[model samples]
Structure formats: C-alpha cells, structure tokens
Target: MRSKVGLVDLVTRYIIRQKGKKIRPLLVLLSSKLAGGINERSYRGAVLVELLHTATLIHDDVVDNADKRRGLWSINKVFKNKVAVLMGDYLLSRGLMIAVDGKDFDFLGVITNAVKRMSEGELLQIQKTRKLDIDEETYFKVISDKTASLIETCCTIGAMASTQNPELIEALRKYGHSLGMSFQIRDDILDYEGTSSITGKPVGGDIREKKITLPLIYSLNKVSKKEIDSIKKLIKSKNDSVAVKEIISFVKKQNGIEYAYNISRKFAEDAKNALTVFTDSQTKLALESLVDFVTERKN
Candidate 1:
C-alpha cells in the first residue's frame, strides 16, 4: 500500500515529533498485548490512535488559545492560528486514512464515533462556559463524554486488533473509562496544586479560562453560596492574578484537591480490578502500574 507521504510526513515531521506522552497509543499497544499477541495491525492501530490524539491537541490549543504544551510552545503558538488549525485538520484526515488502511470497518466506525464524541464534548464545554454552577453530574458527564470516550475507544480498538473477543473488548473499555476519569481528575487537581514548571502550563489556566474543572466543582460544592458567588465574580474579572492565588488557597482549605484525589484513586482501583478477567502477564502488570502512575504523576 502506498502511503500518503506528503500529509503523513508533514504531521510526523512537524507536528507529532514534539514531546508527547503518547498515552492513548500506549493504551492501544498494552491492551492489545494483554488480550492477545501483538501484530502488525495492532501497531498500525496504535499509530492511528496517537495521530488522532495529536490532531485533537493541535485543535485544542487553537481553541483554548493555549501557548504551551509538553513544556514547549504549542503548535498554535509557533505556527500561527490558521496554520495550526489546518495542521490539526490535516492530521485528523491522515488518521482517517490510516484507519482505512487497517481494512477494518469496525475499527473505523469505533474511531469515527470517538471523533464525534470529542466534538460534542468540546461543544458542551463551550456551551457551559462561565455558567459556574456546574454540578457533579454535569461535570462527570462532560469528562466522560470528552475525555473518557476516546480513551475507551483506544482500548476497544486495541482489543479488536488483537483477540477480537467481545468480552475482553468490553472489559478493556471499562478499564480505559475508569483510567481516563482518573486521569482527568488528576489533571484538575494538578491545575490547582502543581507548579507551572511541572504541569507544562500556568497553575490556574483552567480558573483563568473560567473552566469549571473537577476540583473547582468540588470546592464549589463545599463552599457557601456567598463563596460560590465570589468565585464566579473572580473568574469573570479581568485582573485575576491575585484571585487565582486566593482561589487555590480556598480550594485547598475546602479539601477540594483531596476530594478529587480520593475520587481519582477510586477510579484507579476500579481500573486495576478490570484487569482481573485477563490472566497474569507483564502487559497486565504494566496496565496496573499505569493506575499508580496516573494518581502519582506530578505533571
């Protein structure tokens, strides 16, 4: 099969070579291995998942107007918004092409569904912005739709690429869903508690953007109505440098970070348990260790 060298080369050479965790791709590989043996199809599928993830990051940076990622300038920062947008689109299109090359219509359908979910998730966040009364139900709904869905997709594709067992596919999907939720919760906690140097962005970027992440939601639940009003006002204000500090302090005082960590740990445990159906293997152990890494990662 002839590769689309130009588009693939542009994305791999320019966009995807930067420091990325490649977590989704890793999931694909690991899940595939745990269920069955690795194969050429699994490797290609892993690459496709990573490409799709990169495409989303490019688009996310443009939409969020974010400057830094992975401790470096975001593509939107270095390439300008228009180029960044097109680069993202190109990468997404390339991912589709790669999926087709896998010759699995079912896998293609799974990936297309993830793309749809991610689009809807972003739209949901945009629709809810600055409406700071974000409840727990809505918060989980948003994260599951936006973040967990794709991670679940990664595991689903991985299983199909290897063993093609319906039960194992469902099990790994559950594993990834729980892991993804924990991952996002950890991200929300880090936003409140981590240094910019560690997190690869400002400590309060979510607060500055007025994005109601998990910790903020927990803190909002704990605080009085008056405190919620204060937080809403602070988020709406332009000069919020000091307010960011105050919000962080308030969240910690309310045990917002701790609450989020507890929830994250629960999900991590659930993810580890999802592997019980699979027999003992190095890949399974790696998957279990990934849970601890998710909860313990500083960045």
Candidate 2:
C-alpha cells in the first residue's frame, strides 16, 4: 500500500501500526463463518469494513481535533489536518472501489447507508450538544446511527457474502445492531469509570467534551429540576476538570452507572439471543463470546 510520495506512505504506515481492536473486521469474518463458510468475498468484505472503519477514525480525529488515538499520535496530530482528511477520503474511495469492482451492489448500499447514518448521527449530536438537550431516546438514536449502523453493515455483508438465507442475514443484522449498542454504551460507561491507561483517554472525557451520554441522561432524569439545571449549567460552563469530576460523582450517586449497566446488559443479552436460531457451532459460540466481550471489555 505504498504511495508515490514518501510522506503519504509514512502516514499510512503509522495508521496501520496504530490500528485498534479490528472488531469490525472480526465481526465480518465471524459472521461469515457462522452463516456458512468463509470465502474470498468474505475476506474482501472484512477488508472493506476495516477500510471504512479506519477512514472514519481518521475523520473523527480531525473533527474532534484529537491529539491521540489508540494511545498514539492521531493522524491529524502527526501529519496535519489537510493530509489526514485527504488520507481519510483516499481510504474511503478505496473501499468503494472494492465494492464496485466486485459488483457487490448490496454491500455498497449497506456501506453508503452506514456512512449517511453516521454523518447524521454526528450532526445530531453536535446540535444537541449546543443545547445540552440530549434525552435518553435521542441518545439511543444517535448511538445507534453513529456506532451500531456500521457494525450491522459488517455483519450483514458477511452473511450475504457467505449465504443466501435471508433469515440468517436478518438475524445477524439484529445481532450486530444489539452488540453495537452494548459496545458503545459500555464505552460511554468507561468514560466515567475506566482509567486513562485502559481507555486510552482521560476519565470524564465525554463530560469535558460536553457530550451528555446515557449515564448522565438517566442521572439528570432522576435528580431534581434545580439540580438538573445546575448540572447543565456546569456542563455549559468551561467544563473545567473540577466541574466534570463533580458531575461524574453526582451521576454515580444517582445510580446512573447502574442504570446504564442494566440497559447495556439487556442489549448484550439481546445480541446473544439473536444468534440462537443458528445451529450450534464454534462460530456461533465465538459470536456469543463476542457479545459478552463487548460489554465486559476494558478498552
């Protein structure tokens, strides 16, 4: 994957080296195997999913003006914003090329819809953040679009590539969607509970960023109107470290973490239940384990 220019090649290598868990690609392969069998198309599907994921991460870092990713320098941090944006576009185009060259119109449709949903979700979050008005339903909608849609696309593509069973494909899609919801909720929980070393970001990063997640939303609902107003005012303020810490403590005291955990656990359970129709196999077990891992993972 060398480029004609040395700088582009260097940044590409850096990105490859900083790759995260590769969960999307793993879901592609696992779902393919569970549906029927893995083939060249399955491998291509995995590659395309990874390319899409990486491109999104690059763009996200630039959008967030993030300095670090996966505990390493973000592409925008190391290579500057323009180069990072171009590289993200280049990767996205490459992914599209793979789908077009393979004549995988279904996969193309899935990826395009995912990209649209993700963009919409991001814009929605930004809009809500401006008002600090994210409710539980709106938060769920945002996370479903931004995080779960791609995972659903990956599972659907894998099942489509491997088998012709519409039922199986639909089942896997639901499974992926549930798993993705659990995954993101757990990630949000970690923002309040996990260590920076494990999460690769500071605790309460979401609060500092003024992103009202599930825990805070539930906590807000449980508190008095005056307290809720105060919390919103604190979030709308400069979001200083002390204010974020206080908010985190208040959320915990209000049982926000417990409520979020219960909801995430239900989603994880739904994810496991979605695969029950599949014949028992190692792949099925692996997918179930993946559901558990998504909720339990430290990073």
Candidate 3:
C-alpha cells in the first residue's frame, strides 16, 4: 500500500498501524488449505479479500463519521473525509487491478457483484433507518447482502484457486453462507447484550443509530401497537439514555435476545453440517472451530 506522494504515504502508514483482526483473509487461507494446499492463486485470493475488506472499513468510518476504529483514530478523523475516501478508492482499485493482472476474471466478476450487493444493502439500511420500518425479512436481506455475500465469496474464491472439485467448492460456499449469517446475527445480539470493554463498542449504539436489528425487529412484532409506538418515539428522541435503556429492557422482557440466539445457533449448526463433503482433516476441524468462534465471540 505504498504511495509516492508524501501525504498519501502518511495516511497509508497510519491505517496500517492499527492492525485489524484479518479474519476474512484467515478464512480464505483456511478454506484454501482445506481444498488442497495454499498456492500462488490462494495468496492472490487472500490479498484480494483483505484489500476489499479494508476498503469497506475505511469507507464505513467515513459514512458513520466514527472518530475511532479499533481504539485508534479513524482515517476520516485524522485525515478528513476526502483523503479517507480517496484512500478507500485506492485500495478498491488496487484490489481489482491485482485480479485483472492475474487474469482472475471469474473472481473479479464475483467480487464486483458482491460490491454491488453491499452498496445496495447499505443504501437499503439507510432508507430503513430513516423510517425505522425494517421487517424481519428485510433484516435478513440486508445482512445477507451487506455482510454474508463477501464471506461466502471468500470460500468460493478459495476453492476456485486451489481445487477443481465442484462438490467441495459448493460445500464450502454453503458453509460460508451459514457462517456469515450466524456471524451477523450474533453481532446484532451483541448490540443488545454486550459491553464496551469486551466488544469495543458501547451498548445501544445500534439503537442510537436507529438501526433495526433482529432482536428489535422480533420484539417489535410481539408487542402491542401502543407499546411499539412508544418505543419508536423513544428511539426517535435523539439517543436519550432513557430511550436506550427502556428499549433494551423491553426487548429482554420479550425474549428477543433468546430468540435471536436460537436462530444463530441454527445457522451455526448448518455451517458445520455443510462441511460434510470434506474428509476429516485438521483444516476441516479448524474451519468448524471457526464457526464456533464467530458465533460465540464476545464481540
């Protein structure tokens, strides 16, 4: 990610300093290893996934006007929105160029379609957040597009790079889809139940953003229209502490978290079940353990 320009180099350095978890690339590597062995194509796929993930995070920080990322000053906070946007664009173009130069046109097509889905998902969320009217089905649609598409694509790309077994590739793709769904659902649950010290985010941040996650969506359906209207008013009250606390308590009283947890567990089980195509191996076990880690992670 080096740049000839001094300012660009400075921004890139700052971004690299805050090392992310690199979970997406790790999944790519693991998937590749499961199929066969890590090769040049596998490395290319891993790099492509990381580059795309990083670009999205940079852009997300700008869109959210978030001051911090991973406990460090966000790119937009330090360098302003223009520079941050350019940096994200730079990463995106670089990732695409790598794919093109490597003649990974199939991978290019999949990733471009994922990017489109991600954009559509984000725009849809923005629209829903404005109205606070997202339903359970729409919630699934948003997470699938916004979060799951890239993850499933990572598995697809990994298998494509390292193996020709179509059945194995399809199995990994299903595993990734289920894993992604469970991962996002757990994230939504954490918003209602997790703490700042563990999750690196304040509780009720989603509520403050007026983002209707599954817990809230499910709870809203169970409550009377009167109670729902009251909670909606509180949410619209500009992040009032009373509003946040009450809505959280209301969701709990309605068993929202428990319901969401059961759903996440179902997806996690499906994720593990999708691995039946692979014979017993350490790589396969690692991938199965990854499913547990994502679903049960405190964050």
**Candidate 2: stretches off by over 4 Å:** none
Which predicted model would earn the best lDDT? 2
RMSD of each: 2.1, 1.0, 0.9
Q: Per-residue CA lDDT of candidate 3, range 220-282, in tens?
A: 999889988998999999879888999999999999999999999999999999999789999
Selected candidate, larger lDDT, 1 vs 2: 2
- TM-score per candidate, in order? 0.94, 0.98, 0.98
Q: Name the 10 consecutive residues with the lowest summed lDDT in model 1.
A: 1-10
Full-model lDDT, candidate 1 = 0.85
Residues 102-124 of candidate 1: C-alpha lDDT, one tens digit per residue: 67677888899888988998888
Candidate 2, position 47, lDDT:
91
For model 2, how does the per-residue alpha-carbon lDDT over 50-121 read when each residue is reduced to its tens digit?
999999999999999999988899999989999999999988988888888988878898899999999999
What total of clashing residue pairs does each candidate reach?
A: 0, 0, 0
Q: What is the Cα-based lDDT of residue 254 in candidate 1?
A: 86
Ranking by lDDT: 2, 3, 1
